[model samples]
Structures are given as C-alpha cells and as structure tokens.
Target: MGKQIQLQDAAYILKAGWKLFSRRTSLETLQKDKQYREFIRHNEAAGRNNVSDEGKRVYAVATDEGVLFFSDSGKGMKTRNSYLQHLADSFFNFSKGVETLKLYEMEIPSRQVMELADNSIDKLAKSDLRNAGTQLRKSEFSFTKEKMAGKEMLEGAVCTDKYDLRPDYNNFDRLTKEFNLGISPRNYDVASLLYISENGYAGHVVADYFHPFSYEYEFRDLAEKLDDSIKARQSAPMSLHDFGYAALQMEAKVMARDILQSEFHITDGEFRLSGKANRTSQRTKTPEKCLFQQSKEPEPEKSGCQAAKHVSSVVPQKKEKKQLII
Candidate 1:
C-alpha cells in the first residue's frame, strides 16, 4: 500500500540507521583495525581444508573487542590459554611466600560472570612494579633490572594507554585460599592467575613479588597497617631490593593504621587494635613511620636462603620503559 522507496534511498536510510546503532566508542575507534581483522577472518574461513590438526586459530587478548592488534613482532604469542597459565604459575608459587593455602584455580563459568554483573549493577563498584623484565608491569608499578637494585631503585613512569601486563582474574584469590592437605614443598599443587594483556600481546609469569614474604597490601588504612608491615620486614633478609620492598610494605601498613588511629582518638606513641582489626596494626613507634631505612644494609639471614634464592629467580631481567600501572 506504500509507494516503493528508491533503492538508493533505502541504502542511505540503512546506512544512517547502522551509524546510529553503532556509535563510535573506545572499541570502535578505528575502521581500518576492524577491517583488517575481518579480512583475516574471511581468508581463514575460505580455506580450512589445508589446515593440519595442530593448527589453531588464535583470538586477540582483549578486554572488549578491539583493544588489541595482532602483529608478528609480538613479544609473546597472542592467546588466552598460554598467558593466563604463566601468570597463574607465577601467582601460585608457594616457594616465595608463606603458603597459607595451595593456590588452586579452575576456569570461570558463565554463572559466576553473570552473578558478578548482576551484583555490580546494584552497587557503585570498586574497583607493582617491577624489577627486571623488559616491561615490569604492576597493578601500580614498573621497573627494570637496572633500576631494581641498590640506592638507584626506580620505577618506570606510568603508561597513558590502557595496557595489561598479563591477565589475572583473581588477584585476590591467593589471599583467602588455604591448603587443606598437610604437604611439604608444594611444587605441583600451587594455583595461578590468568590475565589478558592490553596491547593485544599477551604473556604471563608466576605471580611473584620483589619481597619474599606473602605480604598483603590490603589494609583498613595506612597507619593501622604499618606496624604489621614492619614486622613482615623483620622476617625478610637484608638485600638491595628487600629494603625497597620493605618500605612499600611499611607504607601500605602504616597508611591504614593512621586512619584507624584517627578513629580511636589515639595519639602517637600509643597503639591498640584487636580482633579483625588486629589484621591492620598501628605502630606506636615513630621509627615505623619512616619509610627510608638507614643506608647500612641489613645482613642477609641465611635461615631461608633457599626460599630467598627461589624468590630472586622470579624477578625479571629487562630494561623497561617504565612500570605498567593498571
């Protein structure tokens, strides 16, 4: 009953509708990038007959759709499985820290994903560095082999673009998990974290830290947590990087403690916290507040020499532009 629209008019209308429906965003920033991707898909689709059993198609490591680009010069192969595995191994390394529990992991299922999304919609949400390795990426830091040692310890500058060092879905998983079985030398039973990197290039390492102890940074506040951080440092051997790691631990522990002290109306030189609050202890001492240790390096305690050596090997060796801050 309607007059037929011209084909040209129809095409124009459809194009406009497409544009409206698909607004440009971070993922759709470039037309060429997606085109290149489609072109590859088309060719691969046209011929699978010549493909061997071992041949596999790799998808880009991504947060969304178009954050990564596939290139041959990639430092590591672009894939979800390999990079995540490496990161998991690194995180689950019981050799470095006091293993409260064996780090175990399984592939996340769709149900968990949906549950997180549904719960997050109800709430406002919430939401390193390295020594060695070419790009010592961290949740908040980066450094190189050269910068990781001595008084010259330095963290590379932060990157502007969103780039993931590796994929780790459960950075917090290690904290809660516990070893059920009594076992010595957990070589095979440790867990892992898998991260899909930002630049599309993906690789992973064992979740190891510069500090040897399985120190946690999560505290109620800075001041409340510093005393415990200092205590943790006392457990560590004296080393070039150990000092820096200790300083970091102290800062995190102390910052939380300060907030707690404010709540209790406590002044300097007096500390008190118990129960769950005991997790974050405040230092009544002034020295605990100081971040820089005396230049006189602490002696290397040989009691845990094997553990210390193992932790040292996990550090990467590279000249990175800076620490990759997440």
Candidate 2:
C-alpha cells in the first residue's frame, strides 16, 4: 500500500506538471493551438482511424478530440469504473473520474420522483410538445447511463435509477431546463419520463415551439409501468426527430430483455429488434406541429460552444428547428 501510494503521488506530480505546461497562457498560446491544429489535421489526412485507445476510456468531454482516454487496465476494469469517475468528475471539481464504487446513487429522493411530478402537476407552464419532425437521422451518438453515483453503482452491471443516482428521473429534467420549459403541460414531469426512458432510445426527432403539453403527454405518456404489450418497432430510416422514436425501438428491446431475464429468469438467445411493424410516413408536420398555435420558433445559432457539444452529436432535447450542416 505504501509503495502504491508513493507511485500515485509521483504520477500525480507528473500529471499536474503536464497540465500546467499545456495551459495557453497568452498570445503565444494561440500560436501553439495553431500548431496543434495543423498536427491534428495532418494526422487526420494520414488515414489514421479515429481509433482511440480502446478498453475502458473516460472523457472530460464527449467530443472525440476533447475526450480524455483513461484505463484501469492493471486492476481489472470493474474494480473501479474509470468511465463513471469521468462522468462524476464534471459535477465535482476533482480531476480523477468519479469513484462509482464510492457513491450509491447520484441523487436520492426524499420523496419518490413520482411526488415531484405530482406536486408540479398544476404548476407546469404551457409549452409546445415539438412534434413536427426535423431531420435528425444522419446524426448518431454512443449512449449510456452516466457515472456520478457512488460505489455500489460502479461495481454493479445494471444502470437502473436505483443505481445511477444522477436523478430519479432521466435527461427529462435536463431537457426541460435547457429549453426553459417553465412547468406546464410541456414541462410536466420530464424527470419521470427520463427515468423510465433511460435504457430506451431517444434522439432529436423534431423541434417546434408550441404549447402542446396536455395534448402530447395525455396521448404519449413517457414511462411504461411493466407494459410488455408495447411491441418494439423500428421504422424505415429517415432521421427526422428520431431521438425518442429511434430510442423506443432500442429501449423496448432492452426493457423487454430485462423483464424476461429478471422476472421469468429466462436466458433466451433469440433476441433482436424484429417482429414489429416499421411504417414510414412521408415527412410532414409531426404530431407536435399545430395549426392552433402561431410559430414563434427562432433560428438557432451555435453560440461559441466549441468544446462542450463535441460528445453529444445528437442534441436530443434541443428546441431548434434549423438543421446544423456539420
């Protein structure tokens, strides 16, 4: 233990030294960035596969270039989840990845998240449920539950709400917050929706600004309480507002597997995204498109967020209607 501690201390010193040296302190920093840019470009043209070091890698940023590759190779992968530590690192000031072995859940509910939705029932503001499908198909991302929860979570294989602790709900709360959907039918119970939809698939299928909370939620209730009847479907590929729709295709399969495995204790190998109807409707105004409302949708501009958006190629909860030509 003493030797290990000494080695870690030495590594820390070297790591800290590298960071300090890497800092762009002034105009000279800009010059160095130009140099790095040239190197990155040249490497790209040299036919290098975006092949990063594989195994278990955690990133400070999701974008490929910005991500920090890490490995817990010597100790065995599950011993400490370097990935979750990478995630929890954001919520905390520490540089080391979140020690999932340490945190049980990201946030424990004093009241079941169900209560949060219930209490806010009357207070949710009226916002549009963007149904008009936008083109989000060509976009893709690698999705997984984030790590910020404590130890039991890191060591465990399942990333359920009971273990994740990022929220009792899922990205629903985050989506609502980002778009500022001040509690109404539109903002109603985003967290609960997210919690239920975690392993299920969702992507940026469409965007429109209208007040359709009551309309959409009443018709498209987010969570499924053990409903096996909901057959998982994958429609023909046209990437319009594909987030939730595509996700449904995936999550349905995952949830189905979980139910069968845990409840029935079945280890069936015959599982895939099949046996569901895949209908492709001509791209028209989606269920979110409304004649009852006036379009106040503004053009979205990419405000100088160069590094943060690198990881999430698919902006799932975005309210923008314009397609970003990457």
Candidate 3:
C-alpha cells in the first residue's frame, strides 16, 4: 500500500488545450514555501468545484506518488472519465511535442487501463516515488452555470488511490496480449509511440494504426522495434514519470538534430558519422583523463582592485516574495 507523504520534490504545472505551457519552481523553493503547499491542498480539496467550467484548466501536478490530476465536470465516474481523458491527452501532447491528437474521440478501454497500470508499475520499479500510494477522490458538482440551451453538464471530482504496483512484466507482446482490446485503427498507438520515443522504450508497443505516410511508419516502426529489443530482458518496468522526462528528452533530441542538420552540414552520410564517432569518444573519457587531456593555458590572476570591481559588478539584489491569488 502506498502512503501519502508531503510532495517534497520540485513542482511544475503542465497545462494542455489550444497550446501546451509549463511553469516550474525549484525543489528547495517549493518545499520550503508554506503558501504553495496550502494552495495545492486547497485546490485538491475544493478548487475544482469553485472554478467555472469555462475557466477550468486541465493540468497535472507531478508528485512523489504519481501525477495528480484535477477534472471537475460532473459527479463520480463522469469526473474520473474526464480526468482520465485529459490525462491521456496530456500524455499524447507531451509525447508528440504538440496538441494535435483528437483525444476526446479516442477510447479509454480496459486495455488502456491496463496500459496505465503497467506503465505505472514500470515507473515504480525504476524509482522510489511510487512507494507512497496515490490519492484519488470524486464528488458531485457543487457549482453550476446557466445551461447552454439543451447541452448537458457534468459535475464532481474523483481522486483514485494507487499503490506501488510491482512491475514484474517487461514483455510488451506478452503484456499487450493479456488484454483483449478489439483492434480498430486508431492513433492511440501513435501517442504511445511518441511517448516511448520521447521517454525511451518503456515496455510499450506502437499500435497497429494506419499511417498516411510511408516515412512516418518507417520512423515509428524503427523506434518501436528498437525500444522493444532494448527492454526484452529487463525486469522492473519503467516509471510513469519517465514518460514526462522522456518527452522533454525527445523534444531536446529533435530540436538538436534539426538545429544540427539545418545550421551545420551535419545530416546523414559523412558529417553525421563523424559526429557520432566524436560523441562516442567523448563518452569514453574518464574525469581524470579529461582533466589531464585539456591543454588550454590558465589566465593571469586578477589584482585585488580588479577582483573587487568584478564582484561589485556581478552581485545581485534580493527579490521580493511573490503572492498567490488562490
């Protein structure tokens, strides 16, 4: 059983909708700040109901146990469905580095629930965060707005508690086979693949969805196979947080590859091979070897007057503490 403990890590907000945006605070700052903790507790309790539907934002708080998500649209299960949809949507967006997937249209079947469980297990195996169980709650809609003619509205909140599930499965084919998700060509696999690529090959497979382009299929297939091969024998499953971290990593890799190819003549053939070799050599260096290998001359020491002047020029003033509008 996972226990709820103070979220002592760095805090960040990842918002999804028309666009994706993230806000972050240092671990030291977030943990020491009384107001921030209060704000999270308040929002977890009543903030979803207090805010209007139009003003409702879909976001996640990366926590010690798992991602804490808030969704207030209707009571009980409805609220859980909404939150789960947004959760998948957020994962898709993070994986692809864009908000283009039609998340509402995608189905969240029993298989997906299994996927989520498997992914969570994998995450727990790789880290200490999930040792504490997660909290989930759902409630009836407390506030209402003028109904738009005949459109129905949902209300409530659901917080689902998850224990640190033992990640004993690592085979994607075997695990996926355990769930009978009647196949229909859907982009959910695209989202998951994008997730795997961004995060690294956790025990997940690319869905057998139709791809409009040959190159897209090739790219995604290669990634899928490669990831599967790498984790074929691993025991502990990947962590859920790795998906978040992996997305950022994938973003960086894509950005770097594009920049390198576009700015420098570093694409394909010769330059790419040379660059790969260069990187390989760099990775092989030990700290002691690297220190001795460097041949740059030391700069002349600065006088007391120069040092004092430099210090005076670079010193920074204190910043005022910020207030929250909660």
Q: Each model's C-alpha lDDT?
A: 0.26, 0.27, 0.27
Per-model TM values vs. the true structure? 0.20, 0.16, 0.20
Q: Cα deviation of 161 in candidate 2 (Å)? A: 14
The residue-by-residue lDDT of candidate 3 on 1-326, one tens digit each, is 75332442323222112112222354455556565664465446354566434343332222112232223212222333333333333331212221111111111212222222212111112122222212222222211112111101101212112111111011121212322212112223332332333233322233223423222453554455544533542332453223233343354336434533343323321123334521111111111111111134533312101110101111111123111100
Q: Give a tens-digit lDDT track for model 2, residues 246-265.
A: 45445544553454334323
Tens-digit lDDT track of model 1 for 1-326: 84454343344435434432233412334234553354345445446668532232222222211112111111212122223333334433322221111111112212222121111011211221123222213322211122112221111111111122111222223212211111112212111111111111111212333212112223324324443544455665353334343344444435434433444322221223342221222212111111223354654322211110101111212223222121
Estimate the lDDT of model 3: 0.27
Error of 3 at 48 (Å): 27
Worst 10 residues of 2 by lDDT: 284-293
Top candidate by TM-score: 1
Each model's total of backbone clashes = 43, 35, 23
RMSD (CA, Å), candidate 3 to true, equals 24.1
Minimal lDDT window, size 10, model 3: 304-313
* TM-score for candidate 1, residues paired by index: 0.20
- Which prediction has more favorable TM-score, 1 or 3? 1
Q: Indicate the residue-level lDDT of 123 in model 2.
A: 25
What is the clash tally of candidate 1? 43
